[model samples]
Target: MNTQPSALANSAGPVSGDSAAAKSRVLQIDRSCRLPLMFLIACSLVWLVAGGFLSLISSIKLHAPGFLSQSSWLTYGRVYPAAMNALWYGFAFQGAMAVALWLMCRLGRAELMGGKGILLGAFFWNVAVKLGVLGILAGASTGHSMLEMPGYVSPLLFVSYCLMGVWALVTFHFRQERQLYVSQWYLVGALFCFPWIFTAAQLLLVFHPVRGTLQAVVSGWYGHALITLWAVPIGLAVLFYFIPKLFGRQLHSRHLAAFGFWTLAAFGGWGGMHAGAPVPRWISSVSIAGGMMMILPLIAVALNWHLTARGAKGPENNQVFRFVQFGAIAFFAASLLDIGGSFRVIGEVTDLTVFTTGVKALYLYGFFGMTIAGAIYYLAPKITGCDWPSDQLAKLHYLGSVVGILVLVLGLVAGGILQGVRINNPEIPFVEAIRSTIPFLGLSTLGGLLLLAANLAFLVNVIRLLALCCCTNCFASNRSPAGSGPAAAGANL
Candidate 1:
C-alpha cells in the first residue's frame, strides 16, 4: 500500500484531469521553489568558474605584480575581494537557499506555496547580488572588509533575504506532517537567525549606528555567524536527512540530537568574536572560549550520526552516499580545527595566513559543499522524473570534488605553515617567505580547475535530467508494452 500517489503524485512533471487538479495544487507550492534550485546551480557554476579565473590571476599577482599592472580591474586587491564576494554571495549563500528549500519540502512534508512569488524573489535576489559583486570589481566598495559590497547593496540584500525567509516560514507552517523532525528545527532556526543577524549587522555596519572597535566587533560577529547561523543549518539539515536515509536507520539518539541542536544555537553566537581578537584580547578570549565550548555540541552530533550508521549498511558503493559520508567526516575535522584556529596561541601565527583559508574552505567546500552535492544527486532524479544522464558524469562530479578540495586544502595548509614559520623567524626575509608560496599557489590554481570541472559536470547532468523530465513523449514511450516500440530506448537511454 503506497501512501503517496504512485502514477504522478511524487512526479514533478506532467499530469491530466483528476490528477491534474491535485497536481496544480502541488505545482503552486512547487513552482517558486524549483526555480531557486535551478538558479542556485546556475549561479554557483558561474561563481565557481569566475572564482577559479580570479584565483589564478591573484596567484600571478602574488608572485609577480607586473603580470597585470596595467589593468586596475584585474589587480590583486580588486581581484581578491571580487573573488571572495563571488564565492560567498554568488556561490555559497545562493547554494544554501536551494538546499534549504529542498530540505524544508522533504522534512516538513510541505510543497511550495506560490511559484510566481518565488520567481519574483529569485529575480530580485540575483539582481542585487550581481550589482553587489560588480560593485566590488569596480571599486565602488565602501572600504569595508568582507562586507565590502557598497552601501546601497545592503538594503537590497536585506529585502531579498527577507522575502526568502518569509517563503521558508510560510512553507514550514503549511507543512502537512505532524511533530516536526530534527531537520525542521534546524531549518526554522536558520530561517529566523539569518534575518535577525543580517538586519542587525546591516544597521550597525552600513547605517553607522555603531563606532570604533564596536563596529569591528559587530562585523566579525556577523561575518562568522553568517556561516554558523545561516549555512550550518542547511548543512546540518542535509546531514539529518542523508546520514540516516543512506544507511536505512533512524538517528541513534533523539535526545542527543536535540541536545546538539540547542547547544549549537546557544554557543554559536559568541564564537564570532574570535576573528576580532587581534585588536582586542578580551573579545578574542570570549570568542575562543565560545569556540572551545562548541565541542560538546559537535561531539554529540558526531556521536549520533556515526553511531547510527555504524551498525547499518554503508553507502560506499553509491556516489551520493560517498560524497555525503566524506563531507560528514570533514565536519568533525573542521569543528576541531575551528576551535584550535580560534585560540590566541594558534591565531598569532595562522590568522592572516593560508591556514585560516584552508580551514574555512574545509568547512565550506568539504562540509557544506559535499552535503549539497549529495542532496542534488539524490533529489534531481526524483524531481526530474529521470535517471541521471550519465553515471560516468556522476562519478566524475564526486571524484573531482573530493580530489580537488583535498589538493586545494593541502596546498593552503602547507603554504600557510611555511608562511607562519618564516614570519616567526626574525632572520628570514619577508620576500623569501612570499617567494616560497609560489609553488603552493600554483597547485591551488590546478585544484581550482579540478573543482570547476566537477561543478560543470554537475550542471550538465542536472540540465540533461531537466530536459528529460520535460519530454512527455519520453514518458509515454516508457509506458508502452515491453516488446513493443522503443523498449530498449526506454531502458538503455
Candidate 2:
C-alpha cells in the first residue's frame, strides 16, 4: 500500500481469490449441466403455446361473448379452466421439475439418481395433466380456480409429484458437497411443501367443499398457496443460483436470504385470502397488513441479487442469462401488484373486473413464466453441446414474452379500471361499462397472439436443437466432450 499509488489500485476493497474461484466454478457448472436443461425448455415452450391460445379465447370472449358460445365444450368457463390447467400442471409443474432436477445436481454437486424413475414420474404427470384438462373441457372441473381438475385427477397428480420429489431429494442426498447451499434450502422446502399443501387443499376443496363466503376464502387461500408452494420456491431457487453464478460471487447476504425465505413461509398464504368479500374488518385489515409486510422479504431478495451482481460486467455466457434477467424484473413487478391488490379499497372496485385477471397474468406470465424461460435457455446449450441455434432467437423469445405480457397486463388493467368506474356510476348503463372493455380486450387478444408466436418460435428452436443432437456429426462431436454423461443421454423426456 505504501509503494502503490492511489490512482493505480482498487480502493473499495481487495478482490479476493475466492471471488475468482466462484466464477470459475459457475462457468464449469453451466458447461456441465446441459441436456436436462434443454428438455425443460422444450416442455415450457409447448405449454406456453397451449396456455396462450386458451388466454386468447378467454380474452376474445370478454369482448364478444358469442365468439365460442355455440359449443358447450368451448364455453369460456370450460376453456379458461382448461387453459389454466395446461399452464399450471402442463407447463409450470413439469418445467419446474426439470429445472429443480438440474439445479439440485449442480448446487448439490451430484449426478441425478434413478434416471428411469424420474422419466416415469414425468410421463405420469403429463398423463394426469392431459386427462385433467380433458375433464375440464367436458365440464367435470371441480369448479374452483386453481383446483379445477376433477377429484379423480388429484390422486394421479399426487402419485406423480411424490415420485418426482423422491428423485430430486435423493439426488440432493447423494451430492458430494459438504455444505448445503442456500438454493438447496428453498428447493427442499418446496419439494416437501408441495405434496402436503396440494393434498390438503385438494381434500378440503374437492371432498369437503366449504359453504358460503368461507368457500371463497378457502379457495383464495388454496390458490395463493398453490403459486407460493410451486412457483415461488423455484423462482427463488433460480435467483439464488443465477445471481451468485453470473456475478462470479457468493451471495453477498446469505443471512438475508434465510430471513426472506422464512418470512415468505410465514406470510405468503394468508394474504391472498383477502382477494374478495367483506370479511370482519380486522381480518381484512390483517391480510392487507400482511400483504404490505411482504415488501420486506421482496426487497431483501432484490438486494441480495443486486449486491451479488454489483460490479460484474455482465452475466455468464448462455441463453439462461436472457431468460433470468427478465424473470428478476417480473418478480419485482409481481410483488408490487400483490401488495397493491391487497388493499380492500382497491379490491372494492377491481374485484370482479379484468384487474384480477391482470394480477393473475403478472404472477403467472411475468414471474413464473420468465423464470421457466430462463431455465430453458440455460439448459439447452448444456445438453445439446452446441450454442443456442441463434442468440437472436433467444433475444426474440425474451423480448416477445416481456412485450406480450406487458401489453396484455396493461390492456386488462385499463379496461378493468374503466369497467369499475362504469359499474360504480349509477348514471352509466351496465351495458355501456361492459361495452367500453371491447377496445382493451382487443388489445389483450393481440398480446396473447404475440406471446403465442414467441412460444411457437421457442418450440421450433428446441426441436431443431434436439434434431441436431441426434445428428451423426453432432453426436460424434459431443461424444467425448467435457461433462457429458449417462444422465445427459438418459434425460429421455
Candidate 3:
C-alpha cells in the first residue's frame, strides 16, 4: 500500500506563475514540433492505406491463389510480409514516434530544442521504411519475420532512430520538472530501450546472422520487445496521461502503477518467446511462465484504469475518451488471450494459425492504434489552436474502426481454430481446410475495408485542419507589427 517516491513526488497540483510559464513553454515546444509531427502522422496514414491494400491482397490470395498469381511481386509470400512490414514499421512506428515526442515535451516541461534535427531524422526514418518495404517486395528481404528489411536498409533505420533518441534524451535531461511521473518513466524507458533492442536484433539477426534456432530466439525476443517495451509503453503513456485528466481525478493507485511498470519490465522480454518456436522445451516453459506472470501487470493496469474512471460521466460522447476506453478494453482482452494461448493445449492449436494473427491485431490495431487515435484527437485541437473539422467524420471513424477490428478479430479467431483443428488431424484434406477458411477470410477482408475507409476519413480531416492552421499562420505573419512577427504568428496558430 506504500506509494513510490516518484508517485508521491509527482502528484499533480495547482498552477502557479512558474507553472503558467511552463505551460507557455509547452505550447512553444508543441508549435516547434507541429510540422514534423504532422508529417509523421500523415506518413502513417498513407502507409495505413498502403498496408490495408496489401493486407486485402494477401487475404484474398489465401483463399484464391489465382487472383494475382501472374506477378512474382504479388505472390502470397512476398505480399504478406510486405503488408506486415508496412503496418509495423510504416504506420505503427511513425504514429508512436509522434505520440512519444509530444509526451516527452509535455511531461518534461521543457521547450523542444533541436527541432530541425528531429525533423530531418523523421524524414530519413520514413525514407528507410519506404526503401525497406520496396526491398521486401523486390525479394531482397532477409527472411527474418519482423526484421525482414534487407541488410542495406537496416543502418539507415538505426541511424535515424539514434538521432531521434538523442533528441529525446536531451529533452529529458534538461526537463524543468524534477519529479518524474509514471508516464515519463514509460516514455523514457521505451525510447531508450528501443534503440538497444533494435540494434542488438539487427546485429544478431541481420548483420551477423545467428546460427539455427538462436536466430528464431532473437527474432522472437525482438518482436516481443518491440511490442511490450516500445509500442505498449507508448500507448500506456498516453493512457496514463489522459485518463485522469479527462475523468477529473487522480490515478487510482500509485502503488499499483509502480508495481505494474516494474513487473512488466521484468517479464515482457521473456514473454515473447512463447510463440511455440522449435527452439527448446525449457525456452517454451520459461516463456509460458513469463506469459502467465504478465497477468499480474495486466490486472493491475486494468484495475487502475477502471478505478480512475469510476463515476466519470459524459465520456461516451467525447471522441478522445471513447477511443481510450475502447483501447483499454482491447488491451485487457488481448492480455487475457495472450495468457490463455500460452498454455500448451491452446498454444498447440493457435500458435501456427490465424489465431495468433488475431491476437496481434487486437494489440496493434485495437489497442495501440486506438489509443494513439485518441491522443491525436485530443492533442490535435490544442496543437493547431483549431477544433476538429467535423464531428461527423470523427464519429464515422470511431464506429468503423471499432466494428472493423471486432469483426476481423472474431473471424480470424474462429477460422484459426478450425484451421488448427484440421491441421492437427492429418486425415483432413488440406483443400477442405482451405475451403473452410474462405468465408472467414472474406469477413476479415470486409473488416479491413471498413478500417481503410475510416483511416481515409481521418486523413482528410487532418489535412483540412492543417491547411487551416497554415493559412492562419500566413495571415497573422503578414500583418504582424515589426519585431513581433514570430510571436504574433504563433499566437494566431
In order, the Cα lDDT scores of the candidates are 0.72, 0.74, 0.80
Q: By descending lDDT, how would the candidates be arranged? A: 3, 2, 1
| Clash totals in order | 2, 3, 0
Estimate, for each residue in 1-493, the C-alpha lDDT of model 2 and write its tens digit.
Answer: 3344321111111121246664454444444444444554566568778877887898788778999799999999989889888988888887788888787876665556656566667778878888999999999998777889889999999998887789788878876564666778888988888887787778778887666666566677677777765588888887677766665565777689888888888777665566445655666676678778788779888998888778785554656776777788888887887777777788677768888787778778887888877776766666455666666666677778878988988898888878887898889999988898889988888888778787777777778777776673345665554445535424522
Candidate with maximal lDDT: 3
State the lDDT at 59 in candidate 1.
59
Q: Give the TM-score of candidate 1.
A: 0.87
Q: Give lDDT: candidate 3, residue 6.
A: 35
Model 2 score (lDDT):
0.74
Off by over 4 Å in 3: 1-26, 274-276, 314-316, 478-493
- Those runs of model 2 whose alpha carbons end farther than 4 Å from true positions after fitting are 1-40, 275-283, 316-318, 472-493
Clashing pairs in 2: 34-382, 34-383, 35-383
lDDT for model 3, please. Answer: 0.80
In model 1, where do residues sit more than 4 Å from their true spots? 1-36, 273-278, 472-493
Query: Which digits, one per residue and each the tens of the lDDT, describe model 1 over residues 347-381?
Result: 77777788877787788788988887887787665
* Candidate 1: residue pairs that collide: 29-112, 32-115
- Worst ten in a row by lDDT for model 3: 8-17
Clashing pairs in 3: none
